[model samples]
Target: MIKQPSIVIIDYGVGNTQSVANAIKFLGYKNVKISCDFNDIENADALILPGVGAFEEAIQNIKKRNLVEILNYQVLDLKKPILGICVGMQLLATYSEENGKHEGLNWIKGEVKKLNLSREFSVPHVGWNDVIIKSKDPLFTKNTDLSNFYFDHSFYFDCYDEQNVIAYCDYDIKVTAAVQKGNIFGVQFHPEKSHNNGLKMFRDFINSIS
Candidate 1:
């Protein structure tokens, strides 16, 4: 039998960590570990970075736990697949303008900026919105499956490469909702809170080995 991949949720102590772990468990992943240990993270089958807070605080917590170098080495050097969720996704960018300028993990070529929607919409585009799929990815087999998902953020990703944007959501203007760059992947929406749509995406992350 093929061995189950050991997925580790990088817990830097700043968000809904358990919900992601619980979601993975609900998906029937038996080897999921929520830890910050270098070995655990470095040796895992896949790494998940889940967060829900300020960009500065999130990066600070990850630094406080000494996960920067380990993540860089494992994810960049070793080329292990890494997935970032919500604020966790923003943390993967080059920098963020949330509360002053803060550097991020710099995994993807992007920057985090506050929502600048027109009068037609409001900031923190919360609620279920359409996730328009731009390209065919491992998670999305059909465009119909990329319907509505939950979102609760004021800032969105401004990807340097338009091709990197796998899926997006419309909020008066096009907003970066999901991004994929080689072994690195990020989702601006909350998959754990998105019910089945979220669960389906989570499985794509867990099983996405490259």
Candidate 2:
């Protein structure tokens, strides 16, 4: 089993796992598994962290599962491509201001702050939006036409390494829609909900390890 390549979706019970799994399957990936088991991390070739809800709750779940250290070690030391979606993306940073002050994975240098746009924009920033590809990365080899994708989040990260940002979207100012630093990747949008473009992105991510 160690020799087999599997895409493990870290099951912290925060995000839309079924949708993400379906997306991976739509991309022609057959070995996708959702697991909270620590051994699953070692056995898999790639990881996807899909999240939703409050930052504090999610952090507590990760900590309770004793997965914080493993996730950091895997992405930072193992040099594996770990993709985080939505609130999952926010968790890759050092801190978040969703409720009170909360610590995160700290794999990327940044803080998650609430959206402070004009009154015209909604608070959550839901629905379809464009993902403006900003940098060159294998995960985004599809194209760079400012592709439209689904986005639903109230908080976002202020990345320390701007170069790692592969895409951006408008909410009030330009918020990072996607990030890729070495092997760690993250997205603020729900790729599983973005239709064809999202499928392509997921496929590219799976192919990154292959």
Clash count for each candidate, listed in order shown: 0, 0
lDDT of each: 0.86, 0.86
In model 1, where do residues sit more than 4 Å from their true spots? 142-146
| Colliding residue pairs in candidate 2 | none
Tens digit of per-residue lDDT, candidate 1, span 131-192:
98886576554336347889999998999999889999889888988898888888899989
lDDT of 2 by residue, 56-84 (tens): 99989999989988887888888877999
RMSD for each of the candidates: 1.4, 2.1
Candidate 2: minimum summed lDDT over ten consecutive residues — where?
A: 136-145
RMSD of 1: 1.4
